[model samples]
Structure formats: structure tokens, C-alpha cells
Target: MFEEDYKRRFVFGSDYGTSDYKYGPITLGERPAVIENRGYLPERSMVSKILGVEKDIVVGKDVAYFLESGADLSSRMIYPMRDGVVAKSDPTAWRVIKELTKFSLEEFKPSGFGFKGYYIVASLSAIAPRYMYENLINIYDEISRETGLIHASTIIPQPLAVAIAHKELSCVVVESGHGNTQVAPISRAPIRDAIVALNRGGSEANAITAEVLKDSGYGDLAKEESLVRRVKENLGLLPLNLDEAINYAKRNPEHVRAIYQVPGTRIKIDLAEYSWTRFLIGEYVFDPNHEIFQSYFKRGMPRPSDTRVGDITFYGMLDMAETIIRAVERCPVELQPHLYSHIILSGGNFMWRPVSTMKGIAVDSQTKLQHMLRDKGLENVNVRLSPEPQYAVWRGCIVYGYAIPANYRWEWEKMEGWVYHTK
Candidate 1:
């Protein structure tokens, strides 16, 4: 009975990404439940007053219902990790994170005898400050006190989690999410000093997509962030050479022209004469320094600015090749080769597919990176996407949770092990 109960103790892995929170108990096997990382705090309503719904914060899928109710979503809705880091002063963002944690834990909270709280491993941005870590720990402690929902919890960097997931101890992990991208060199452990962060990511791609929409006479729909993102994912194409690709696209407009229909809506977007510009979206992601992007900057698109957040510096206009080279060079010369050879691209931003119709012209992320490296005289570089880029961090969390000794206690200095919560 003790053994059975021990086996039943909840073990969860949570990847707290800027765009979505991917979480599940390790027992669920491979996949985890993905929910928008945003939360909605509903205003006090007559029904709530009568029902005594004190906790107005709603997280995950339920926020959709609140949004549909037309209850001032812009003011009420809160995205915790808007830029991969939440300020200590932001209570609403912290509340959303806390609610997200509670929702996930309660979802798989088992029912039976000898039930202890869950052992969870949460992944965060590589550039997250020490204060952010402390805040999360305090939040978890509160959750534990309110509901006994956590036995113990620890945090890991998202890129490190990606390395753990792929079992690549000595590789450069480039984790590109919606808000930003982190390039971390891991040799058994993350090389903290060598990590590079980029201010640009998927959202930047969406920005360019919005520009393309406006150019294509869809100026009204350009403001629809979700629609613009969908159009980007469906129609965007990364090319071998931006200039050549654009010229080819201009010459052969019929081949590149395509239309994307927004799901669950009657809206359809046609690239039309602007079809060639599709390549610009993907090109901008890899090399934002391209002169073509200058037009958008002139037109008032917020150019990705170099900013220092926490202990890390996020470069605004750095190309992927330069970013990788810069990060790897910061490490020991002997270890740099190994790091360069095994480049692990993991994240939603790297999720690119080949355009079957545009086979010769279209290149996936790996191919693009490989070509970029080759151009810089780097050879034998093996760049590949994580098996499940979206789930890699979560999987790594699970593996980490299982491997960590039960008796281990949280240490502030090392930032590992379990944080014991006391009421």
C-alpha cells in the first residue's frame, strides 16, 4: 500500500512560456495540456456577489468564456510573461501565474489515502532575475498553504530544460518562443556567462506579417494580432537568400501567390501582388538587419531595441549566425567546437515547414541555420529541431523531477532542489 501510494504521488512538469503554459503530471505519458499563459480577472458581477465568487481571476481555457462575455478584455486580461519576464511590482501578472499554477495542480489533484502534494519542476526564461525566482517560490508556497497542492517545487531555465529533454549535455540550445529567443551553451550544465538573448522572436514575425497585410490592402485586419499570427504561420516562407528570393518571387508571382483563411472566421487573406513579401517575414526573423525591414521601421514599427533585463543583454538586430557565433565564442575555445557542432533549435519560433509547392525555394529552420553557418566558414555543424519543440521543456522538467533525490532541499545559491513550504 505504501509503495502504491508513493507511485501515485503527483509529479508534474510545467513549461511557463511567454505565450502558453504547457503542463501535465508525468504519468500522462508524452504530451501535456497547453493553455494560453494569459489570465482574466472578471469584474464583480451581481451573480458573483450572490454566489460568493471571491476569486475573480480565471486562467487557462476558462478565460475564453470571460473574453466572449465582452467584459473589457483589454483592461481585465493579463499576460504574465509578456516579455519573458514579469516585474516584481506587477501583481496582476503574478496573480495570473499563481492562478495558472493552482488550476494545473487542482486539475490532476488525486483523490485517495496518503496523498501528499505534487513534486513539480517549473521552467522559466533563461534571463529571469533572481527576484523572479524568489517571487515564484513565494507564490508556490502560498498555493501550498491555501490548498496543500505542492509537496516540493524547483525551477530550471527553459533552454537547460531543452538540453535535458534531448539528452544533449554539450550543445547550444536556442529556445525561441513568442516574446524572445535565448541561445544557451550547455556542457553538462548551462554556461551562464555564454548565454545570448535576442529581443526578436515570433511576435516580431507577426509584426512584419501585419505590415505585409497592410501593404496587401488588408489594413483593417492588420491590427488583429491573432489573425496576423495565423496568416504568418500559414503563409510565411524562409528563403535561402532574401534578395534573390524576392527577385525570384517578383519574376514568378503566380507561383508564390497564396491565400490563408482564418480558422473559425469568414475572413480570407490573399497575398496577391505582395506574395513575394512572404519570404521577408521569415528572413526578418533570421536576419533582422536586412535593409528590407528598414521600411517597416521608418513607418513606425517599434524596432527591436537592445535592452538589458536582469543580468542578460538582449540584442535587437543580431542575425542568427552572429548570435550563435557570439554565444559560442564566449565559451572556452576547446569546448566551442562541440557546442557549435550540436546546435539544438527548440521552440515555437523555429517550427517551420517546407512549402511543398515551393520546394526548391523554401527552406526549413534547420536548413536555414546550417546554410548561415556554412557561409561563415563553419563546417560539420549539425543543427536540428527538438523532437517536440513545444513540449521539450515540459518533458525535461519531468525527467528532472524524477531524477532529483527526494531528500534534496532547495538552495538559493545553486537554485536547485525542492523548496520546503511552511505555513
Candidate 2:
């Protein structure tokens, strides 16, 4: 009991995002350290000969070294949370997740004062299954056994973490990351039954951007996913009206035309006549049902299909507006209006900025969501982007860790409070 009391002083937050793992103790001010949520399992020969290390897995920045060693990246690299959830049977994915957790804790493990462990608050997908939670708990327990890195831990939904960061007890959180989008309604506590998961996000935007690249004669460059993403970030435009935006681009092709130089390379891509297709990238994310996107699907691009991942049915073709409505309607009617009024957008996917030069033509995520809601008869809707969408979950973890009472025991039914892993 005394040891558990001592552990409360060092609180840590870990956000297991699809693209990156954001983690650090509460002392890590404002933001947490981010590492790509990936790992590389070094070949047995290399581990024994070159590195002289017995560890089988390499994580975070070290993964890049293995990549540079000319290993077949496809076989060696592992992205555990690529789809935001790991299956029970996938040992490789589980290993990556375990290594990531260990890597994070070790980085900040204080050396002095006979450190006991850390009180950790970890965030996961809102629709994560019981098995995923169990898997994570087991992983943390293993780390504790090996290094005494965890005193206790608790897991909360990513959307709930975002809500906690903003002290929004009653708001709808639309968190879109690289792999998927989660729309969750909260009224003090998250309405788990009402949560909606979408199999679309920034990655989908990247896909459309790649398609645009192929159409613009940069077919070879499109194969490089990272390069295609950079081009998309630099050139993609969210249109106020998709049809009008395309027509405007056609009329003033010179204004829309752009040349993007790869940051560290001399290669420059000139989207001359094909610049108009840039709007399609953003449009596809909000509403893949748009007629324009059909061409890409027909031309071999994989269509986003509805999938069921452990009780949560992810809608692939639903637009942002319809998704919000679908999720909100599941809650009590009395709470629906309040949720609409405080619609909070949180995630990397919503961190888009309006191109000021484009003026009336360009739109930011908030404006786009508002317009979509209004079209669906949602009047006086207030959709706002999270102040720090990318770090909101991490921040919430910090706050949750600090606020939740150390004595409060975990209740499976409520799914809140600290779960004491080490006595």
C-alpha cells in the first residue's frame, strides 16, 4: 500500500495512436514525445553478428537503422496498430506492441530515489474490444515483471481522452487518425453503444492523392506512399463546393497549377493540367460517395468496404455528416441537441488549414463539417476543431492520470478508475 502511494507521484500518459505512439510522464509539458507506431524485427544473424544485441525487436527511431540496412522491409517491419486493433492470434503484432510499450517506459524511467513504478493512463480506439484491453494489460504486466516499469494502469477510449483534455463532459468527439475515424458521443461518460467507427481517414486522403499523382504523369512517384502523402499535404485543397472547385480550377488552371519539390530530393512534381484533381483527395475523405471518386474505385483503387472488427461495425462509405447523425441518434433524444451544439473534432485528420490565397474557394475542416451538418438539416450546429488535435489524447491521458484518485479501484462495468497492476 505504501509503495502504491509512492507510485502516484509519477503519472504517465500513453496514447497508442495508429500512426504514432505519444507518451511521457505528466511532467512532459504541453506535448509528449511521438514515435512511429512501428517495429522492425532484426534478422537473427544480424543481431548476433553486427549489433551484438540479444533483443529480437527494434522499435521507434532504431527501426530506421534496420530499414537502411537493406533488409526486406515488407517482411521485417511490423505495424501493430495499423488498423487500430490487433487480433488475438497475431503474435508478431503483439510483439511489436509490447516492444513499443517497453521502449516508451524505459525512455522516461527515472533512475534515482528507488523508483517503484509509474501510474499509467493509456488510450485506445473507442470501439476496442475486451480482448485488446486484456492483451494490453498483459503486455504491461510483462513489462512490470521485467523492469518494474508500471505500478498501475488504466485504459480509456481515445475519444474519451480527447473529451477529458478539453473538460468536455458532454460533447461528440470525432477523432480521425491515419487508419480510421471514431465518432463517439459523451455525456459525462462515453455512450459506448452510440459510438460509430469509420474505415476512412488521412490514409484515405493519401490514397486519393496517390491516384491524383498517377493521373498527373507522376505514376512512378505515386508508388512511394510517403512522397505521395507529402504532395497531398502541400497541394491538397478542400473545396467549398466540389463541382464548383473543379470548374474554377479548369477555368483558371494557372492559379491551381503547382510544383512540389520533394524536401530532400531534386525531384519536382508539376501538377499542371491535373491540379484540379487535388480537390478530389479532400472530397474523398469527407464523402467517398461523390461521383468523382467512382472513377478511382473503378480503376483498381480498393473501395472502402464496411468491416466488423470485434463488435464495432465500421462504415466505409458514410460521409462525415451522416456518420455524426447516425451516432448521435443512438443516444437519448434529450441529449442529441447538446451533442450537436458541442461537436468537437479531434485528430490529425481534422488539422487541415484553409489555403488563405485560395480565399473563398478553400475550406478548413470545421467549415466543411458545419456545411455538411447544415445540409442535413442540422441548424445552429457548432463544429469546432480541437486546439491541438494531434496531442489532445496524450494531454487527456495526463489530466486523467492526475485527477483520478489512487484509491479508486477499476470497475469493469463502468470501465473507469485505476487498475492496480502491482501491489
Candidate 3:
């Protein structure tokens, strides 16, 4: 049997990227809140638009909503995690956490039964460094002192938790949230090889796409940051057929291109006019002429093989591939095959097929010296792209509380802090 008593836990995951702070709550077995219009009410509201229930039930409460008061508050809720590190390094973030805990209890309606415990599922990345671990503990302790809710601990790595939730082992986990593209090799039990790229993610791509569109000088349309993001999501990759794409950019700039429209603002562009800029943006991944490839190819150029596609020319693709390969190279030799077998990918950038498609080359480039060994046709080298790449980290953290064994609770508390214990 399991602990069956109703215990209110505040489950939250955050993507504190370079530009934004996003958070949401998670529930283990029951609805946590009766979500209302832009705010949650203690009392049940109308029927759930999706679940067809009389009360609008949300499985987990949201810290963003609580901090922003469901968009009702004037002060913006800011996430302090940046580059997979908490930026504030101060205690304010903890205050927000405590408030979120209070809100979660309100939503879950923990009985007049005195508060039993408060738990949180934080990112394993948050615990990677010793200093980060200590800061997190400080934050947690502060929250406990303010809120008085007891019982708290952190679970496994974010990617590992997600793997547990998906019941997927021997897979690649990628989380591209705000700042970094985090890759982890996951088996059914734990993470094997974890690698993170500092300068690659959705935000960078968004900026590149936006700048490209702006340089094209069409209308104010596609140049808008929001519009660029949408367009990049929709049709941002370099065309498989460069000639065809070039023609498309030239002749039908309006249809092939995009524009953004707000209530009062709008912009459009004829991408053909800014083809050079587009190509520059594409170089972030597909630049075959990059220093590394150019050096290698120049040394010994081979005639095009029938099975091989032409060498990649997109700069972005090349960088992504090279980075992954480099990281793979940095992995211990004994763990290489195991890590490759469990390539788990997450991140908003991974949403782009062009980015994911280069994984083989990226891995291959680094292990090129082991060409014979790699070419031996290892079928187990798999790249597992998470279904919802953006939410994986947060969702994983939410379930960590349930997935990990309880034996490590002390370490978790020492690193994170005691949960909010209300006397």
C-alpha cells in the first residue's frame, strides 16, 4: 500500500531561460485547483471546458499564475534561472516560492487537517554545481521559515524524471527551454551522459530568424520578434533545395515569407530582398564552409558518394552538429557507446527537424577517428526526441517526487532545504 492520506504538495517546474521565466504546478493523484478566469477561486466554478466537469480542475497549480496572480497581478513574475543557473542568487526567489506554496494549498484545499508537508521537484541541472546546490538550499530554507510548511525533498534529474514518466529508457532527452540546449542520456533507471550547450536554444534561433527577416526589409511584418518566432516555427529551415528556395524567396516573397500582426502593429517583408541575411541566419547551423569542416574537407575531399547527401552548408546546423560531436568526444571512451545508445533530446530548438536531423553527423564528426567502429552498423544508437520538448524539464520535475526512492531525502534537504512546514 502507499501513503493514502491526502497530502498537499506543491509541484513546480521552471524554464528560466535567458529571456523568460515560466512555471506550472503538478499533482500526483488529484486535482489541485479549481481554475477560474485568469484566477483560481477557492470555490468550484463552472464546468471544465475540456474535462466536462462542473469544476474547472487543474492537476497542478502554477507559480507563474500565483505570482502574477493568474495575470491579475501588476508585478511580473520573473524566473531567476538562467543558463541553467539561478541568476538572482538571492532570497527573493524563495519568497515567491513560498507564496506559490500557499497558493497551491489554497487550490488543493488541504483539509483543516494541519499542514503535513510541502515538497518541490526542482531541475537536476539546478544541482549540478556545488554552489548552485547550496544556493538552492538557502532559498528552500528561507521558504520554510516564512511558510512553516514541513516535509520537503528534491527528486532525480529533470530528464530522468521525464524518462520515468514516459517509461522510456535507452533514449536521448533534450530540453531546450530559454537559455541552453540540455541533452541527457537516459536509461530506465538514471542518466548516463548529460551535456549542455551554452549558446544554442529557441531564443537564439528566434533572434536569428527575426534579424534575418528584418534585414530583408519587406514590411514591418515578419521583422516583429513574435512574428519571427511563429515563422521560424512554421517554415524557418534552409530549404533542402537551395536553388528552389532561392527562387521561392525571389518570386513569391509574400506567400513563402511571413508577417506579424498585433492589434495596432504589423510588419511584412520580401525575404528575397534579404536573401543574404537569411543565408547568414541559416549559417548558425548549415555552414559547410565553417573552419572545422573546411579544414577537414580541404585536406582530403572525396567525390560525392551515391548514398551521401552533399556536405551541409547551414551554419546553425553545423554548429549544432559540431557542438554535439564535441561533447560526445569529451565523454569517456567506455561510456561513448552507452551514451550514444541513449541519446535523449529536449529543447525548443530541437522542435526544428533541421536541427534534429544533424544528430548523426554531429555524433559522427566527433567519433570520426573511430569511423570503422561506428560504421560497424550499430543499430542501438538512438536519438529519442521528447514529444513536448519545451515542457519536458518542468514536467519531469513535477513527477520526480513520485519517481525517486525516499532514501536520498536527506541529501535532497541538505541541498534544497526542508519543505514548508506549517506548525
lDDT value for model 1? 0.87
Residue-wise C-alpha lDDT for candidate 1, range 165-243, written one tens digit per residue: 9999799999999999999999988999999999989999999999999999999888766678888999999997888
How many pairs in model 3 have backbone atoms within 3 A of each other, for residues 3 or more apart or on separate chains, i.e. clashes? 44
Please, what is the whole-model Cα lDDT of each candidate in the order they appear?
A: 0.87, 0.87, 0.45
Tell me the deviation in Å of residue 372 in model 3.
18
lDDT tens per residue, model 3, 1-423: 133232224444433333333344565332122221122222233433343444321122442232322333323333334445543454544444334434544444345665554565555442245565555556556656655443454534555655655656644455555444545555454433344343345555565566555455633544344456665665455433334445555665554443334335443344554543343333333233334334323444321111211221112332444444545555556766776665555655555444243232222211321232244444455555666655666566655654444334445534432233333
lDDT of 2 by residue, 1-423 (tens): 664456456889999988889999987899999998888887777545776766689998877666644337667777787657877889989999989999999999898886778999999998788888888888888888899999889998899899999889999999999889999999988898999989998889999998888888889888765687788889888887799889989998988888899877899999888999988878888899988888889999989989998789999999989999999999999999999999999988886778777776778989999998999898979998998899999999988888777898888888878877777
* Full-model lDDT, candidate 2: 0.87
lDDT of 2 at 174: 97
- The 10-residue segment of model 2 with minimum total lDDT is 64-73
Looking at model 3, report the run of 10 residues with the lowest lDDT sum: 305-314
TM-score of each: 0.95, 0.95, 0.60
Model 3 stretches astray by more than 4 angstroms = 1-25, 28-79, 88-115, 124-128, 148-150, 187-196, 218-235, 238-255, 263-318, 329-338, 353-381, 412-423
Give the 10-residue window scoring lowest on summed lDDT in candidate 1: 1-10
Candidate 1 pairs with clashing backbones: none
